[model samples]
Target chain A: MTTTQLSPTPRTTVTRGRSRAVLDRDALLAVLAEGLVAHLGLATPGGHPLVLPSAYAVDPSGPDAGGTLYVHGSVAAGWVRGAADATVCVTVTLLDGLVAGRSAFHHSMNYRSAVVIGTARVVDEAAEKERALGLIVDHMIPGRSATLRAHTRKELAATAVIAVPLEEASLKIRGGGPVDEPDDVEAGVWGGHVPLRLVAGDPVPDADAVTSGGPVPPDVVARARAL
Target chain B: MTTTQLSPTPRTTVTRGRSRAVLDRDALLAVLAEGLVAHLGLATPGGHPLVLPSAYAVDPSGPDAGGTLYVHGSVAAGWVRGAADATVCVTVTLLDGLVAGRSAFHHSMNYRSAVVIGTARVVDEAAEKERALGLIVDHMIPGRSATLRAHTRKELAATAVIAVPLEEASLKIRGGGPVDEPDDVEAGVWGGHVPLRLVAGDPVPDADAVTSGGPVPPDVVARARAL
Candidate 1:
């Protein structure tokens, strides 16, 4: 597979501290794929901006592959409506650990984050929209989408799905242990990294399940263990 | 303790999808207190917006208490410098699970999110800046500030600390199992919640620790267990 090069623009450039910026498209895609939620930033019509949590997935094998990030919500969501026409920023971050440095000034977190900037186009076609919705479901738990009840036509109409091309994006990350100053290291403080990971606990079967006595599906069990 | 009410402004009102907006000030504060990172949204001088993650803490006691959220970074960071007078949106989100509903459309995640909107004021005073830095350190690991090496004057001057007031804030949360439609419930599909939790593993002692063989500090040990 040939890879496309993404030239850094003024907006995608990391102008701040350190050399943590990751410019490779594949590297950025990896960060987006692992993250479960994205914080979407949109400006109100009055021009005040707001950042809200949202669920999203990257299309791996489709016309939109390597180009589009899919996000969906209720049809009436103000951001969902406003995003179709306005340029927005979607950020996905995964925190890996708490870096307990030797001093108060140097404490940091081990994390991987990506920010994508673009205007979203609404997926209005029924077939395409349905596939995007399925991608989202399986994105959270692979293979479970096939087993879940299909989306009704009314349910598809009630949902708003938008695709934002991944043309302008950048990734930043920090890892490993505390980078303490020489003096602080000599001061004999208990300093190291406390690793943190997102793990899955045992699934709690819904009490109101109309269908009872069936064993928990193997796909769901595998997803839990994978997490 | 008297709870101050936050009046709903045009920006604070949840004009979007479901009514997941949280109104209680103390409730919003609790979300802020439990969060480890915040994604700050800012517009570039060229009019494009961006969201970047940063470590933050709410000041529990001080002249800035009850109104300020503290964030700090290198003095040379572009976003940190540009954010002083700009109206910014700081969002903190905690993910709790993968809600696998019986159908694709109803899939969701259990999460608690808080969005704070306001202009950030640079903390220019040396003493206030120092205190804010300590607050951020302790915020990640409770009681960490008292044991860490003191911030040297040079480190204080090298950092830029900004305080964004928590006046215009709102909380949104979703919990429990998938809310599947009645028809899907009757279809006998697997439906439940796979809980996702952030857990900490044993601390990896720094290889360069000047003092060796010391037991891990109780505060650090407790933090790992609490996660």
Candidate 2:
């Protein structure tokens, strides 16, 4: 059942930085949506932990317990083979700023992160797989998927989409300036944060596109500005 | 022994995307140095995999097998306790651009990523731990450590520094514009890429810094510009 509050399982609860833990479901979704890539962690057959970055998408109305998070990979990837039906951890982090404290001990980063733990299942249903693929594309460039042609059958066959329920999850956010000790602050040490953001530069069209293709589409321009 | 080329172990070999694999150790180091946070993966005591983001620093002339990668955490953190002497994976990714292919299948991201797998050990040595903490601070803001006072005894006691050898590692890079299918190109579909970069905004000074502290240091400005 969908819940407005994040009901973190015992394993997902934040025990160390309890003050940074956010229990609002919308906060978790915001973190997932703003992030472009996710780090998927799982164990190989030999039991060694592995972490790999992959493009991901989230659907709040998805058919999982609370929602669904989709991460795609090449079907031939070794990690993809091990990810099917395996207990995995998905972590997405967006670095907001760099905290410059008066002392080294107080130096930290301003970031928003979401961690989801669940058993990942490979999507085999053709319809859901196709929709997930579209969502993934739109997640990167909104409205660009509709302008493109349909994926060929062979292309679909080579891709593997893994779905994980966003049921057991936690969100952590650390923002604002550095919290320096009173003595350090009184010492008049320069302290603050420099904001960091992912920004898009001018689009570089393919050589062939520049020669033959028409002007860059409005959707592409909008996507660049949105970033 | 220090080697210039990356000698990937069987587990670190790039079987799926061999063409994108980089064997140069310098490339791996470049990616690590550019990244601010790393996703650390390890199996918890219950055997469930966990992934968390942490600030990290790389020391090439370190005492580890090849080099050393350090990640610090609160000593009270549950994962920090579980990470000591355990097999772990650390992945650092810097997203470069978004590939807008003619079709959804060819859409991808241009990025430089480094993945290191090794056993992690807690830094118990007083000197090494203190040096690692300084490195972590300087890694985030170069030259800022020298400007600050030393860490207090109690502050150091609350921190746990984990070191992982940079021996088993692999680097993958994807750059340039979209590689669309010939058919899609023939259809006159506009395809290109938008470059993405982490940029720094103006420094937001702390309330006390604005009143009593001096101006933002040159090192802080250099760090912001470097990004």
Residue B135 shift from truth in candidate 2, angstroms: 0.4
Top DockQ model: 2
TM-score against truth, every candidate = 0.93, 0.97
**Candidate chain B TM-scores, in order:** 0.91, 0.96
lDDT of each: 0.80, 0.90
- After superposing candidate 1, which stretches have Cα over 4 Å from the reference? A1-6, A61-65, A210-213, B1-5, B17-19, B62-65, B210-213
lDDT of 1 at B220: 78
- lDDT per residue for candidate 2 within A7-33, as digits (tens), equals 777788787767776668888898899
Scored by TM-score, the top model is: 2
Lowest summed lDDT over 10 consecutive residues: which window, candidate 1 chain A? Answer: A1-10
Clashing pairs in 1: none
Give the per-residue lDDT digits (tens) of candidate 2, residues B40-92. Answer: 99998888899999999999988986799999999998999999899999999
Per-candidate RMSD, Å: 3.4, 2.9
